[model samples]
Target: MRDRIDEEITFRKLEVLLAFMETGNLSKAAEALNVSTVSVHRALHSLEQGVRCALFRHEGRNLKSTEAAQMLADVAQEVLALMSDGIRATRDAAGYSSDRLRIGSLYSLTINTVPGIVVDLKVRRPALQVELALGSNAELLDKLKQGTVDAALMAVPETEPEVDALPLFEDDIFFAAPANSPYAKLEAVDLRDCRDETFVSLGEGFVTYHGFVEAFRVADFTPNVTMKVGDIFSLMNLVSGGVGYTLLPGRVRGVFGDKVQFIPLRPQYLMRQTIGVSFLRARERDPNLLALMAVCRLRTRSVG
Candidate 1:
């Protein structure tokens, strides 16, 4: 019996089996389950095959359950009810209520955007508990896909079928240099003008790194990057200490106080980053994700 049960029975088959018994018609069962009639027929056939028994009697365009099928349906009802109760209890024990949200963001946003978003989310859901993860663009997106984080705030991801993103604001990329540096005086600097300048850059995996590569490619010169730091704050410190210049989004302008200058690149370079919230398309219907998206929409106008 154990071997037969292992081969033929499954929770999904049990659900279809019970639904078929309750409706007593394949089409009605399909409607109740919100599935196609063909799907209900296939599931019933598969269930019979797994149990290695004839569980239904064919009656001219209708499927009628046998005594064995009726007994299985009764057992299925109790099992499904108990399983539902178990799931609810488990969720309660794990503190995984709908009010909890797992959010991810780029480290740069911690300076402004994240703080304000958290405050807004708390206002809307007074009992909400937020778990925040701050990392590079690559890391945040990976976590979203893996389901470790529910939502992310970062540069708009490149085209991917699995990801769903909502664009919040556009941030122009700007050249950052020490306040006393010669490049700091320029209203706008041509990328080619900085060809010989030593530069500090955020390491690979960061969105800014890719933007820098594109900007330099357009300028048709590889920058002499002297340092590759992991975080924007450290990169900003390197530039402010006169080690080298770097590029960053306009949103981070307030971080450096008066130590660094932010000069927009010439329009010809076309360097800009669009900030957005990203999540797996599969998680789109999640209640916590919906709440975070609401906050994102409300805060969109406030972002520069």
Candidate 2:
């Protein structure tokens, strides 16, 4: 029984059978399989012997498939498809390239940094598919740690021993206000002078929010934050519409055009956020992550 099972129709034989059924002739099947006509004939003959059935009948110089051949051809299609799916699943489970890269980033990085990195990564790996997930700094970090995302672009965390980071650039936080506001005209503004200002800010867990809290702490008072938002763009929209003032990274300067103004903070309250790519240290050798790190290094050099 084991010998019979081993000698039963093989995938290669089934491929030849399917090719013959598809093209309807030995010569055509040989052309499709990139083999000689004699090889196609031998494979089909071997398949018939293994199955102990007549899969084809010679009609002079032409051959016609039997009803059995048609049934086997249909099953061959399904078998091949399942095999292909299994191979892809196995590769993905083993951390091999599944031809898709999942990337996480802060909403603000979508304005500039993420776009450039994605474009460069595609240039390096033309067939790689990139999936981008946008969220706050803490949210992206969580996704990276959970392995829901392969890598993340955000403010590098202070302590993550199990993670590897590639610093791309440093961005300073600026005081953001409506274009028509009095603060827009200043060369720089002291955080202390804004003590009486009503403010809108990003909710907790965002790196910018932490910076906001520390900057105000240096000014010796807690900011009167009247509202909190989840994303940077909405916070900017509120600032533009005169809803209230907020802080933003310099990377987002031109995104709002003249609708909003970003003023430098006084030296005592200055804070710079280090933006970079973060991934699991275990995946440091992953080709996709390596490509991302290279792109970031190029970006850093270009910025410098």
Candidate 3:
């Protein structure tokens, strides 16, 4: 029988091993993890000790995975994935079992769509509570995928195998610039009119970015991004600051003061993004989430 180490192992230790496998060298692994080589080395050693065998064979500062470790890598990934799934399910239950509903959204939705829906829902369910999580579309989608959120209002991706989305409303993108910015000078800006202009872009995980990218793609062009920020509000602020032009929604203008101006797009290269609620496939069976979805649909359509 194989012997287990006296001490217990942890998720962090397994994560370190995954990092090591991705990059065979400890230094590189630590670099990827933003940790010191010594810390990573210690973690690997701890994992090896717990498993009662050498996972990696090292010679002259070079590390090579043994056959056992290679086999275990697949198991490690599965275990980690399952652990994440379990944690999310538990957390979702905790979040939902209470009076509160954990909701997530893309930056654009946060500005008007989510607020409007939430306010309306609050009026109807005065006893209910809400917790908001904001981020890029990808971030929210990842959360919804894992059952970390009761629901999310955002744009559907080009494709998601696991997600079941109900379309709330489809809205077009706008060419919104600061009131006095150069892009606002156009009498009517064509899709290709701002070809060489610098755009203030949304950071990763945004459905706005996805829609913006698709607009450019349909125009057969790419944006010259001068800046990328984590939230759309920041992009609007930068636009009002006259940093650069940004592609945004008409509703986004409501959030800014007179300092910002947005123009209606020609929509020649248009892709209308849908704002809707998404939840885990399993949770669709839940009465609470489904009940929440109905409120979401009503609020999104009537949202001002």
Candidate 4:
């Protein structure tokens, strides 16, 4: 009957109309929305102006909704619900899906750290489907920036401007050797003591690889690195088979089993891996990420 609903009519105006209609009082509607009563009055006025319709009748100090206002209030609830669902769907398509979580982690964490976190996350969000990715530290960071993964669990000290890190726990680095190796009998081994010993190390881009290099640097000599491998387990296996010794996270000792021994480094040369979750700062507010971070915080607190 009247002109078509104006383009200026917005979802917020619809919300204000619905709140006022349901409450039947401006003050009540304002209380619900945590806004001033005057603000609620202004929103209703704005809605009327935008739609070019009288949605309410002023009766003394109280406001009464007209027939048309009652009808619009009922429709506004449905419209708001539909708009919310549409926004959620759009976000899911843009990679912030709540139904599923895309996660990245280091190969070293697959044994213990990753599993514990995954199990805890599933327990907290039972309906959430988890997609796991494993890679070297650099590779996982790259995947995070590219949005190929929503969050990553990796060794920390990450300084990428776009990345937000939450350190879970600290893990000591140690020299891994065959259980039968002579050095296994000692409480600690200085990096210089193994100067002539052949070393099997993780390749560049892996966090342990950098730590290995720094340990040697502190010792003032280069290691006789015989092989540069990709995975920590492979490097450990090589060490256990008497191929060569390798430096690794002590937390993985349980994974490598009794075949390998983890010897702590001298205090001054000690390098600890700060294992944690890393994600884009932009994704910090994403529902899926917020849920994952909550689980991580609880788990880390229990461990600490």
Best by TM-score: 4
Of candidate 1, the 10-residue stretch with the lowest lDDT total is 90-99
If scored against the real structure, what TM-score would every candidate get?
A: 0.75, 0.70, 0.63, 0.80
**Residue 160, candidate 1: C-alpha displacement in angstroms:** 1.9
Q: lDDT per residue, candidate 4, 1-304, as tens digits?
A: 8768786678987888888888999999999989999989999988888867898898999999999888888888999999999988888886785688999999888888888888988888899999999889999988888889999999764558888888998988988888788887888999888888998898898998889999899999998888888888788889888999888887788775779988888987899888999988988898889888998899888988
lDDT for model 4 comes to 0.87
In candidate 3, which residue pairs get closer than 3 Å at backbone N, Cα or C atoms, i.e. clash? 136-205, 137-205
Order of all candidates by TM-score, from best down to worst? 4, 1, 2, 3
**lDDT of candidate 2 at residue 7, scale 0 to 100:** 76
Q: After superposition, how far is residue 57 of candidate 4 from its true place, in Å?
A: 8.1
The top-ranked prediction according to lDDT is 2
For 83-172, candidate 2 gives per-residue lDDT tens digits of: 989977876885557588999999899988888999999999999999999898889889988888999999998788998898888999
Better of 1 and 2 by TM-score: 1
Off by more than 4 A, model 1: 1-74, 86-99, 301-304
How many backbone clashes does every candidate have? 1, 0, 2, 0
Task: List the pairs of residues colliding in candidate 4.
Answer: none
Instruction: Give candidate 2 regions above 4 Å deviation.
Output: 1-91
Candidate 3 Cα deviation (angstroms), residue 143: 0.7
